[model samples]
Target: MTSVPHVPVVVVGGGQAGLSTSYWLKSRGIEHLVFERRTAAHVWETTRWDTFCLVTPNWQCRLPGHPYDGPDPDGFMKKDEIVAYVKGFVAKVAPPIREGVSVERAFRRGDGVFEVKTSEGDVTCDEIVVATGGYSDPIIPRMAERLPEMIVQMHSEQYRRPEALPEGAVLVVGSGQSGAQIAEDLHLAGRKVHLAVGPAPRCARFYRGRDVVTWLADMGYYEMTVDSHPLREGVRDNTNHYVTGRDGGRDIDLRRFAREGMELYGVLDDFRDGELRFRPNLAESLDFADRTYNGINAAIDKHIAQAGVEAPPPSVYEPVWRPDAERTALPLDGSGISAIVWCIGFTPNFRWLDAPVFNGAGRPAHRRGITECRGVSFIGLPWLNTWGSGRFGAVGDDAEHVVSTIAARLEGAAPAIQAAE
Candidate 1:
C-alpha cells in the first residue's frame, strides 16, 4: 500500500489568511502544504460582482510581510485589482499549494498526529490550521420558492451588473453591506430599485477630515478583542455597517437612495400567495441605521478632541427622506419587479472539520484562534482576535497569532493558548 504523503503542517485554505499562515510557517522553516479546493482568491475572482471593490481602503491589505505597496493605498481595489494583489502575495510567499485539492475532513488521531482527508489524497501532519474562515455556502431564503418562477432570482454573489438582470424593476432583500452596495450598483445603472432594509447598521465613509476606517484604526478599535467587548461574542452576529469605497468612497445611505426615487421597505416578513409582505418597520430600521452612522462620527469626534487632532468640524446626518406610510405588502403578480436579489449573508458551514473544537451551532469554539484540542486550531474567523479578524485589515495579526500558537506547540512550549478551553 502506498503511504499517504505527510508534512509537519497543513493549511486548509489558499486565501490571504491561509497563505499568511503559510508565510510565517515558511519563515520558521516549517514544511507544510496548502490545499485550495479552487484557485487562489477563488471567491474574489468568481463570486464578486463586476463592479465589486473592497469596502476598506487598500492600505489595510496587509498579508504578513507583503503589505499593500500599490499606488492607490487609500483607494479601494476593484475586483480585478484585488485578485492581482492576492495572486502577487501567492507568488511572493510561494507556498507549497495544490490548487485543485480540497481538504474534505480533518481530525486528530490517537497518536496526536493530524489526519487531513483531501479530495485528491490524504496527508498526515503534526498540526493543521483550519484557515477556511467562517463563510461558506451562499444562502437563499426558502421564501424564494414561493416567488413566481418567471421572476429571476439570484444571490448577491451571482449578481454582476444591473443590465445583466431581467429588464424590469429589481427588489434587493436584506440591506447589509452587500445588499446596500448591490442596490447602489443597480440604482447607478438606472434600474428602478426596491430595497428591503434590515436592522444592519450604517457608518460614514469619511468623518471630520479623513476616512472613518482610518480614524477607527487610529483609535485602536481594530485591536479591541471579543472578550474586551461588552457584547462579547454577540457582536459577532451583528451585521457590518454598510458604507462604500466605490468612486473614491462614500456613505451608502439607503434613505438617500429613497430620496433619489428608489423605493425602500422594511424587513421582509414573509411571502404568501404571490405577494411579498414586509413588517411595518421601515422608518424604524432607517432611523437606526442613521443613528449608527452618526454615532460612529460622534465617537470619532470624541477621539479627535481627546487626541487634539485637527480635523473638519463635526456634522450629523439628517434624514433626507421618510416613508409616507409603512409598506405592508406588495403583490408580485403585476408588480414590475422582474428580478429579486438575495443579499442575505451566508450561513456558516464547518461540518468537515469533525473536531471537538466546535460549539453546538457548529461554530468553532476558541480563545482567539487557539482551540483546546491538541494540535488543532482555527484562524481567519470573525472575532478570532478582534473585529478586523474577518477582513483584510487585521488578518495578518490573526495569522501571526495562530502561527505563534502552532510554533509554541512544535517547541513543546505552548502556554496560555494550549490551556484554552
Candidate 2:
C-alpha cells in the first residue's frame, strides 16, 4: 500500500553491542541507521539497580584499542560512570544515533536485503545487525504469575532498593547473583530475607585473594574456542552466577549475603494467604543444586594446579563454600515485601527478526555472531568472542570480526558509499 524506505545498513538497538557494531561499520565508511527504542542514556540507566556497578576491573574496560587502563585500573566503574563512558564512547566514535526509534519487525526479503519495520518507519537494508542484547526480554517463569497477587512482586530491572519494597519478610526468588544481592540488601536493611535457590550454579567473586574473573582472564578462559571445545556447553550450563551483581569487589558476594542473615531455601513449593512456602528438603537439594558450581570450582583448581599457582587448602571451601545452617526457609509475611524482584534473567527476542538465520534455540545461528542469513548478523551475545563477548572489554574483537565480515560482503563499494552519504 505504501513505499518502504531504504537504507544501506540497519543496526537494531543502541546498547553497548549495537553502538560498538555501528562504530565499526562507520569506521569502514559504511552508511547505516540505528533504531534505539529509548534515549541513548536511558538504555543503560534503565538497567541500573541502586547499588549497581561493573564487575570487570577498569583495565579490562577497553573497547578494542580504547583501554580503560587508567590510573585506577583495578577499580570497578559504577553504573553512572558506565553510562558516561558509553555516552563518551558514542559521542567520540559514532555520533548521531537515531534515538527513540523502536524496531517492530525485520524479515528477509529473500532477495539480497532485508525489510526492517520500526516504530518510526520501515527501511530496507542490505545488512542487519541485531544488537538488541540477550537480556531484552526478562524470562519470568509461568509459576510466578499464578502466585497470589497479595504477595507483591517486581523484577530486578524494576527494583531500585529495599526501601522501595513492602515492609515484610522478603522472599527473593531466583538464587542467581541478583536474587542473592537483593536478599542480602533486604536482610541488611533489617527485613527478613529468604532467597530461593533454584538450579543456579554459585561462585564467589574471589576464590583466594585474586578475582575469579581476573584469574579466568589470565588463564585465557575467555579465549576458549567454541569450535573445538565443549566449554560452550559448560559455560551455558553454569552462566547463572554472573547474572547477579555479586562479584566481591563490586558488591558483597553471596556467601557474605548468607552470613549476614539471609535465609536460603532450596525451591518454592507454594504460597498461600500472606505466608510464602518453600520446599522442606533444603540441605540435600542445595547439595544437588551446587554440583555444577563445585564442578566449576574443581575445574578452576585444576587450571591453577596446571599453571603451578599455589593452590589453597581445599578445606577452606570444602564441598560447597556456604556455612551449614540449622534452619533453611524463613517466612515472609510481615516484611513489607509487596514486590517481587524477577532478576531471573533474559532471553533473546528475535521475533521481530523474520530472517531465517536463527538456530533451533531461536538465537541467530552464527560463527562468532556473523550469521549465514544474507545480510543478517548478531553481536553482544554471551561468549560470542572469547568469554567476554557480552562484556565491554571483549566486544571489540567480535566487532572487528563483524566489521571485517561486512567489509568482505561489501567488496569495494565501501568508499563510494561513504563519499556519497
The candidate that wins on lDDT is: 1
Q: Estimate each model's TM-score.
A: 0.96, 0.85
Tens-digit lDDT track of model 1 for 237-302: 888989899999998988788889899998888999778999999999999998898889899989
What tens-digit string does per-residue lDDT give for candidate 2 at 1-421? 9888787778888877777887788788888888888876675688667777766677788775456745667677777777888877777666447888889988876476688888877889888888887777777767676766787777787778788777766677776666666666677678877677666556555665566677777777667756545764345435456423333364334445666666676667565554566666556645644555556566777788788888574413444245465343444544545566766677778788777787676656677777656577788887664667787877877877777777777674332111100
Alpha-carbon RMSD, candidate 1? 1.7
- Which has the greatest TM-score? 1
Cα lDDT, model 1, residue 15: 86
